[model samples]
Target chain A: MSNTISALPGATYEGAVRVQEMGLCGMISLRGDHGDEKLISAIKDIMGTVMPGQREIVHQDERAAAWMSPDELLLLLPYADVRDALTRLETALAGTHFLAVNVSDARAVFRLHGGSAREVIAKLCPVDMSPGAFGPGQIRRTRMAQIPAAFWMPDEDSVHVVCFRSVAQYAFDLLKQSAHPQAGVGLYA
Target chain B: MMILTCPCCGVTGEETEFHQGGEAHLTRFGPGSSETEFHDYLFSKENPKGVHLERWRHAYGCGKWFIAARNTVTLEVYGTYAAQTTEPPQDIKDTLSAKVPGWSWREFA
Candidate 1:
């Protein structure tokens, strides 16, 4: 049996900011009534945190939950724990009108690190990257150059980006070019 | 370069972040309806120079469809509301009514 691999395992690019592909992180696309008690408790049990607010992301250690929309969420955890987490969610909310599907392989994650992290992302995305406008705990699903992508900051200088696996290479290249040393726009400085 | 605010997620962004879904609040003429009704439903659209209510999807953001009230000529946006609504909200209507005197679109005034 062939071992499962990520779209760009261990891929790294060092420009003004560092871009590294984070391999094989588990992601579950959960859709349901966010106000439902069963769904809330089920997610709390699996993610160890409360459901996030609009465009918010909550994390405890490696487990995290991101509010994707009014009725949807994205759960992030260890790749090996996906099956178990899905089973737990299914069993916990057996009769509820909810959906929990493993989307780990369908997506790719990247970590952007360095002082110019926000500038690199600002060049590609149309979001307000100013410190007061965008900071940690906020997740934005926006167009990254020519593709759809989501990103959140872990701290002041590090950003975590997510995009479809099919566009992993393209997204990486876009980030690489945006992070070129001479390409800094100094908007966020 | 239209700027829109999505009521679903409260994200204000450029038009590139959204996709226009055409006219809003249309009465569907589904199966068993008369041929003319179906044709009008499919082909007919309101092309107003001012104070137009249309459907817009926040395609790159929250992926929710919402209604946008804007002027076609001046590009002035009155407001945006939920797509599930059957009519423009009272405040949006009032805003449009004040800006464009005696403005009425189809059955709305």
Candidate 2:
């Protein structure tokens, strides 16, 4: 958690549920035609790396993930990177028309990293979150509030992620409620 | 419910997979579109209550984007295309060979 707690104003928080404010500055959706080999190379050149390709992600100076289908990739980096990245990317492929959308405000991130985080996330999310099934390095963008959210297994008990900001608060509430009756062993103490 | 055909995985799934693109005629925006016209464009939208071409994503299931011919009137869906693409240089030929993220557009097409 290199980033700090920068509060997002509009969304409400329970405060009752243990919440950690994860400020994900921005999300970039870089889309090129599937067979656009030239564009693919340009993306690799600008990012200094290629997209993981498929349901995988690689973290570098900027976090890149092969989300959904092959033609699209999701990139996450500080808000500062937007200008340079977009400019270099667009200039690199001037004539080639590609889709690069800035979705920082549209998405948010939250980590259920406490001792009971796994138990809580598993009960709420339909996807299998077992330590063995979803370990570090694996990424899945699935539904949480019926809204598309990205989830990744960063560690044994740490499920790091980014989701749509509109439903971020509700998604956090539902996850906390999944462990309502059973409080965290070391959460408060 | 709106049925969105996945361009990647050919099959009709719940409209849940797609993110609703407001109107179909969005591309028709051109020059001399006056301020009033822009107002009408932004505010007064043509929400066809019948069958129309809409953009939706295979959000939860396939993670693909396709065009869904949705009978907004009857709420029945007829078909979906991975790249009813709205982009020139259309057709799967150019983009088919390269691996599409999680799924292949060629395998199904």
**Cα-based lDDT for every prediction:** 0.94, 0.59
TM-score of the candidate numbered 2? 0.57
Task: Say which candidate scores most in lDDT.
Answer: 1
**Model 2 lDDT per residue over A63-115, tens place:** 55445456677776776677688877788767876788887777777766655
Point out the worst 10-residue segment of candidate 2 chain B by lDDT: B100-109
Model 1 lDDT tens row, A1-189: 789999998999999999999999999999999999999999899889998999999999999999999999999999999999999999999999999999999999999999999999999999999998999999999999889999999889999999999999999999999999888878878
Query: Which residues of candidate 2, in runs, are more than 4 Å off?
Result: A1-19, A179-189, B1-57, B61-109
Off by over 4 Å in 1: none
The 10 consecutive residues of candidate 2 chain A with the worst lDDT sum are A9-18
What is candidate 1's CAPRI-style docking category based on DockQ? Answer: high
Name the top TM-score candidate.
1
lDDT of 1 at A185: 78
